[model samples]
Target: MHKLWNRIPPLASDYSGVCSILFELNSLNILYTPSGCVHPIVEVDEIRNFDNVFFYKSNLSDIDVIMGVDDKFLAEAELLVLNNPNLEFISIIGTPVSNITNVDFQKIAEELERKTKIPVIIFNTNGFESYNVGIYEGLLMLAKGLSKEAVRNPKHINVIGYSTIALGYKYHLNELVKVLENIGLKVTFFASDGCIKSITEAAKAAVNFVISPEGVGAAEYFKEKFHIPYFMDIPVGLNGISRVLKLLGTHLNVDLSEIEESIVTRTELRGINEYINKNVLIIGEPLTSIGIRECLRADFVINNITIITNLNSTKKSREIYKEDLFSQVIFVEDEEHVAKYISQADIIIADPLYTIFIRKEDNKIFIPLPHIGLSGREFAKMEYEYVGKMGFEYFKKFLKSEV
Candidate 1:
């Protein structure tokens, strides 16, 4: 089998991504597939405890699947709304079953919206693609459905595309907020908290800081509709943090010299004053890999860095990384492609599950940087630093022990 793997598994599909994006938002999110399809996420990828009523699995039966019964789904939706009447919107996320059945998700979504008099967003995230596409379309649907006409708040900002599972927890927002608040700019809205208020307040932000590829669609929407200036970047390394600050300061017209100097001061306090020259490989989604690659180069002074990932960035995301000459992004076609890079790397930093691709006897340094999308909650340490200043510091801890 071309897709069979000895150890590594396939990334979570699109419906999971869409669900993760909507996980924290105050909306009625339903997966339109057999009940079993929701298991991969609810038991593993999702950190939300049970008893949460907003999210549901449509519980399609053998007859419903055979007949393609839209009425069965609508009846369930009507009951959910009847119980949770204060919902701002409803989202119908699709999975592999829907794709195989060739269901008309859009028509059903239109019918649902018309019947309920609330916004119904069809994510169209059939299980064909990986989670990034889900996150991308999920946020895009969110922007399309929720963003409103409002006067812009000059110092206000929204951190889009940063959700649990793929990007770690919303505490990453706290790290960035600490940075933004120091420079007289504040994060007015962060969507990862599962707060519906963030969705409503999105239109007023002066800038939308896109943290992952998933947010690209939503950021573009804000720019086009609200005329808000947004740039795509994840705060990872020391320089990566500075780069984001520079992007934000330019838009908000604030001074960041004090903040930049303080980051250096804190980094120096960590006693990291060495240029670590080694062949290193970073793997995972483009969002995480790209951030770690940039962090390694600018912070560790490692020039021989290379990245391998299964996910590719948007055209605009590539442009964002074009100026990053320190490393290159390789899209892995198969396990062999990954084997080739890990074979060359003296050190590897990625999700722990990628260990399946490497040799156990090799004298290579493998640092555990667990991504929730890859390893689920088994390995991802939410407080262990995955973004911004704290992210770099956490990475530096690995350098101290392994490098």
Candidate 2:
């Protein structure tokens, strides 16, 4: 029987790429999903090597938050902060009950901070908002707390929106640091892969360039609070990097050599892209799904793009991306269906659950998790050699073998 405390049904996308990303970035074991949605989270944990992830029934009865009012959450925060004191930043996410009860998260956090000397911020994640909004807001809250520190140096530039996961962050951060430093921009700060010191010095940066929608709010907060200019857009692949260079050129009043390098790199990727087989069915998070699908389909034909996700509170991906661009699109809720469709596809780019389903089969290939931004494409291609040197190599290989 479903637990009484669990409220909402699990999102179909819960078990794969999106779940993996959240685990890698947030350092969370159990997501605070409603009890009814248990299966999706369970399924997501089935395939991946996620060690720090677990699920909690967040459907706190109205009585619990309003009347019973246990200090569980506040205590949990204090414990986490104490353990990770460098956690100068703390973000609190509220479930439906906490939202409706009008629980004073700020007050609770401030009280905890007063006693423990740690900063805690609150982000409301009730039904009104989607994960896209939740992630951005969470980032903003984290940035706001961080803005309190004095500037250490003007060369400090923060990487907003890339991520907190181990998958792509390792490669992306290294490349980004090299690109910015090569262009004479002193590196300031980076998130996900950033240290506590850099985060503490966030207010000191001259400007902020946000690469993901999730990073946009933090960029804006830094801009408004510190008089630092923030640029919001993707900074991956060739075109995305060019866009960043263009914006930086305008801000710093100088020509950007990064633009030249980005163009050359993109041209090289495009040449490699031509050799890739096109037929594919991509299953992952929306941002990664759309970005990868859009890039791959630019000059090649993508047979179909399927999003396997559990973020049911958000609209299906078919509505997220323009429908006219794809040959077919579907939002799947069942793993059995996902496996069946993948079996027929030439290539598959998805999380480990899907990967394990296809791993033993000679028909499909796995593309790994956290495939976001244009940069992920090149990373996938060159690093994995299955997509475009940086984009969709396994899918390409699968298609070649299938045809």
RMSD for each of the candidates: 3.3, 8.1
Error of 2 at 21 (Å): 11
lDDT of each: 0.75, 0.49
Candidate 2 local accuracy as lDDT?
0.49
Per residue, candidate 2 scores C-alpha lDDT tens digits across 1-403 of: 1122122233222122233333333332222333433453344322334454332344444345556353765555556555655444444455554556667666766877687775555555553433444455556655665556575455556766654221243454455566678776776544454255455567777778665545666777777877788765443344444555777777766777755564435432333343365346666545445555655544235435555443332442223333343324465545566567777766567644345566564645555553322122223323432122243333344334222
Alpha-carbon shift of residue 249 in model 2 (angstroms): 3.0
TM-score of each model, in listed order: 0.90, 0.59
Estimate, for each residue in 69-174, the C-alpha lDDT of model 1 and write its tens digit. Answer: 8988898898899899888889888888888888898888888898899888887766767777777777787778776787778877888887676777666557
Q: Among these predicted structures, which one has the highest lDDT?
A: 1
Q: Give the deviation of candidate 2 from the true structure as CA RMSD.
A: 8.1
Give the Cα-based TM-score of candidate 1 against the true structure: 0.90
Worst 10 residues of 1 by lDDT: 266-275
lDDT at position 310, candidate 1: 61
